[model samples]
Target: MSIADRRRAQGFTQEGFAFAVGVDRRTVGRWETGKSSPQPPQRPRVAEVLQMDLDELDALLTSTGARPKPVRSAPSAYYGSGDPDEMIRREFLRLMALSGVIAAIPDDEAEALEGSGDDFGRMNGHLWQVYQLARTKGSVYPVVQSQLTALNDALREGRAQAGTLCFAAGDLFQLAGELAFDANRYHDAAASYSLAASASKEIGAYDLWSCALIRSAYVDLSERRYRRAADTLGFARRIALRGDGSLATRHWAAAVQAEAFAWLGDFGACEEALDEAEKVASLSGQGSNGRWLRFDGSRLAEERGARYLQLNRLDLAETALKDALTLAPLAAGHSFRRRGAVLVDLAAIGAKRRDSEQVMQYGLEALRLARISGSGYVARRLRAMTVELGNLGRDRHIAELKAEIGTLAA
Candidate 1:
């Protein structure tokens, strides 16, 4: 029988059943119509209200053609035989589904397994290193997806401690959010960050929670929601204060706050925040957790440049961007997305100064990098630079540069 039939058999209307389970009547209607399944936290309450055990409820829920498909194992040759990019995308989606299944199980009922928390922790640490060192950030998505699957499975199967699971989930969610953000999926990124913050708060991981909030603020900042971003950053700063003052979390919050303030045209506040971020260098030990939290002020120069560019301080922007270019890794080993962003900012500076030659030089280089990396982040930045170029008139070189960028964008 379907869930709706079982509910009717038990003499409860949809609204009555929803009231018993403390969910909206629409939620019950959706469950009956196969529009959505009960989430993990709702499963126990749902089973109770239905007067059935978990297994019986599962069967009823699946009886209405709403069951999840059985997960398939990857073929022996899957890793090396398929088109590489397609393989990554397929595996990434599969792993994401696996995480969902794992998340759906209740902690108390999950069977205890033999995996150690340290094992998962170490593996996650290595994945973070791989991501940081990869040429294009997209290359890390598959690995992050896999790690998230494993971590979720471990948690659901009771192989990891509750606190450890929460911490790991928080970190993995942040990394997932980064992938989504770079792909220009702002809504997805915001959702992931919200999940991360929720997980971190469950474990009282102040630094992780604050970092998630700061990352969420970036989505708002990118969308030109300056006041909302500032509010988020301000809340993150307060959370960071409750943690280790010596950690980079507070400083990282300040750095992002600097950008938001610059966007608001609060030059004095921006500079003060930048100064706070710079103090991380004078402190000992870099203040990072080496895995999900690494803010040693390495990106400060580039960030300062971007902030200055936003504030229309072309002279300061040029100097900071030049220093950033020197400090950033070379083309062969560097992050294409990061380098492309700095180059785009330099092009903006050139456009502001009406230096056609400079604009072409930086703009074309950024376009080349964007094409090579296939980064939506770089493409978005290029689109913004195009708007900046509107005032540059009809110079032949500038027109040619814009045409090339348009082609790359297309």
Candidate 2:
């Protein structure tokens, strides 16, 4: 059957289907026209709205000759001179609205999950929907933050059940913490993580509790508080050991330990932790849904690259970073942040060699990616690289690069 036919079979008009799937109606028109195709990440939502599995949807599209062309990475040509703060805020609200609908479970059926009641499964799915929505856009923060406050109010008013409401509240707080981390607001991130940990503990959400601790450790790492970071991650690691040995919990603990050891300049311990991390990557199977398993060792590659960068092992650093760049999925919004980081490191190596062309090339790309993602963390790191690049002296291109970096500074 054709893609349109399948949607019609599912009782959705073109506009109705587009609205249901969170996309523009014209984009849907183009899809059905076979003029273009939805991106891979978008396909799952399309299937969900059509009430078909992904494979079946793909088959229908294929049968209708709806082929997707490759989308090449283009340099930022339209970095608008608009207020980024406003843009970020708008995007955040859009994501929150999306999350609200996606995260809602029917009130009647919501009570069945505890003690193998259906409520547990339903709530788990809803929590995961919120998590996935947050992962897609930085703009979801305000909505999540509002939800966190609302959940607390509900608890205070004694208007909600303890089990499901508490779990949902913890999940919302965790997403807020994640958004704070993304914005490079470490103090806010730390506070949100602390609240998430408390809520998770209250709800017996061991996985989420350990994850929150790992997040808190990242804040400590940002402040160069290595010893404190280690303490936080060590506590998480211990808790993870007693909590089902879930792949996500174990991998997160090992990844943070690797990062902590790297900061301490303990290469031996870092490598050992990395080895444990690799074991998690070697799991027999990963569920197809990426909602819960986003931490599958990609950052470990970045950590290795950063460690080598710190040790002045430029050759190893370059190799590791290139490996990280290869493993990072370009369409993943956060991958730009990672690639920008590695590029900055590589640019540093170019500076050491007096290779102005290489430095400009990599540094410019990093700057562009940082601004596009509004990644304050990457933007800060790139600003530091600008200072080192300055000693190169007397090039208009270098001057322009510095200008760009200045705009991104916090």
Candidate 3:
């Protein structure tokens, strides 16, 4: 039997086994889904927790052929170790060429996307993966623009499945909005997000549709259109309620609503939304395969710090941001951009308090992390710090920091 099956037979729930094995329940799900193999670190523990011999556990997994190939941060030999950079360049060129050809074709005359409807669905899914890789590497704008052009052309030619095409279009526009928002191009982000919402609505992808709305609301918040943002996200909340509530959709809506409430200085509403967001903790660390669910409770501290910062409650901001800094992982992963933003906010609060030393320490560290992640959003927030610095002097340190922010210039 598989480990999951064996555990069930032994009368242990997946969660029960996961707790005993020192991993998230989603980790168990990954094993069951054949997306991961148990690491050496967990071997003895797995054997002990499941009451099986080490060799027997190994035999069962190996014989069932359910074990995943071990993952690597870098490309594997099975893909024939080409230079990663070179491979990326080649793939980029290939995608660009395809996009160019599709663009040049006359809309009514162009051939449809080749293959069955399932093939088109899979292609759309693959495009989402491509989008993710580009977003992660921090220069996705061009790729997304290219892909969007291709998809648009396909739709014009009637070459793509309507559902797949609309979903892909929605996703691409959302990414464009994200790229623009990170750059502090609020108006541009709002336009792209509007397009995204329309596309998602076309296909009835409620989760994606709500996500686009929430993204647009962020632009309003950044522009200090707090009332507009709150109104917009209220619509999003209703749509999210209709979605699968798998922690992702619910907590994401709650988190953004929390931000909007905080910005409006509605202390009661802000705390209420935050309390709702806190419920996400009960369902934390549950994402698999890097899905776009950013609502994990890991960012709760950071979000709280941001709220306090907006209120100019320096002591509270300091404590929350410090906790966030401690909880945030050192390596580049999901929360890197968020933690950097929190740190920048904390630094800004310090600046308001005339704590130059605190500003230097937190601001520099936040800048370093933001650059490493190439996060446009965090970089833009850092720009606001310059306004906060406000003639602190032509002091060499302040001037140097300004120059550094300039380097991140869109």
Candidate 4:
């Protein structure tokens, strides 16, 4: 028997079993998932909670359990028993799901995944960290989709912690939207963000809702509908205001709003929004969860530089971009994406000044980082940079840069 089967046989929910054993619920989940085992000190408690001798517990922990059949096979005589037509209908639907004609997870399997809010929180946070650090973002997609499916099951069942689970759903939706946005699938990203916003609103998670709306606005921003994005962001600002003041949600929203303002050539409005974003520095530890909201003020300089670059203020952009490169995180090589972005912006400044040498200097550095990280984000930015390099007019080195970037992005 696996730890999961033993725990369930003891008539304990995963969360309840963890409480009795005096460990975090996710620890039980890890144990059951065969990812980890209880330490020597904790084994006694775990054995006691499962009502088993220590030796039996050890054997259970080391053994695998039978996988449940997704569609149960009825007994030979069941066709003659109660409500045969209803049974037939249920079996047919299960068959369809099993055949991949429709999406569904077996009820038993889905039920086994239910846990407390902290479980989802810890899982989502860990997955976010993995996604952010992963060399290829697509590698994280399968697990996110699997988790989301299980989460939908939990929601459908309306479990005891429905509201908290809904918050997790909203956060996961935002993550899905991020993956889509990073791939430049604006339509899909917008749909995910909209669902995220709805989920957040259903649970009164103001900050999450505001962040979802801000992300949704990015589709508009990417489409070059500056006024529309700005308007959407204005509403997001109000939504953020209703959230916890200590969170950096409002500040992050303001920073993105600055971008729309910059693109629209409203210097005063852009400056005011930037000023609002600066307030994030006043909050302790940048008031970020490092998962759902990773503002942390680390990229504020880069953001300012990018906004200025958009407005073609090359000198101002150059100054901020250089400052961004000097930030502790970037200098220590902690953030590949941000550093690449700032470098690209610097290269664009060089292009605007018609200095091929300067352009090559920054562009080559950015290209090297992209190659190392294999990040879709860096490749996407490079795709845009190719346009500016084209305007630099027929230099051999420039052509090499363009070819390398195209191949990398492809």
Best by TM-score: 1
Per-residue lDDT of candidate 2, residues 152-220 (tens digit): 555445455555554564455566566656655454567667766765565565666777788889888
Tell me, by lDDT, which candidate is best: 1
For model 3, how does the per-residue alpha-carbon lDDT over 1-410 read when each residue is reduced to its tens digit? Answer: 77778888878898766655557778878777666767643554466566675567767667656663332324222111112323333343344345432323232221132112444345445655665555343355555555555665666565755555655656667766666566444545676788778766655666778888988988888767898988888898888776555646666777788888887889888888788878866754573213334456778888888888877778998898888877775554545576678778877986788777778888898889777777767776887677787646566787677667655523
Candidate 3 off by > 4 Å = 1-138, 283-292, 332-336, 370-374, 390-396, 399-408
CA deviation > 4 Å runs, candidate 4: 1-117, 329-333
Each prediction's TM-score versus the true structure: 0.70, 0.64, 0.64, 0.70
Q: Which sections of candidate 2 miss by over 4 Å? A: 1-137, 287-293, 329-334, 390-396
Q: List the lowest-lDDT window of 10 residues for candidate 4.
A: 76-85
Instruction: Give the Å error, residue 300, model 2.
Output: 3.2
Q: Please give, for residues 324-377, the per-residue lDDT of candidate 4 as tens digits.
A: 887645557557877888888898888888889998999998889888876656
Which lDDT values do the candidates have, in the order given? 0.74, 0.63, 0.65, 0.72
Query: CA shift at 75, candidate 2, in angstroms?
Result: 32
Q: Which wins on TM-score, candidate 1 or candidate 4?
A: 1
> lDDT at 381 for candidate 1?
84
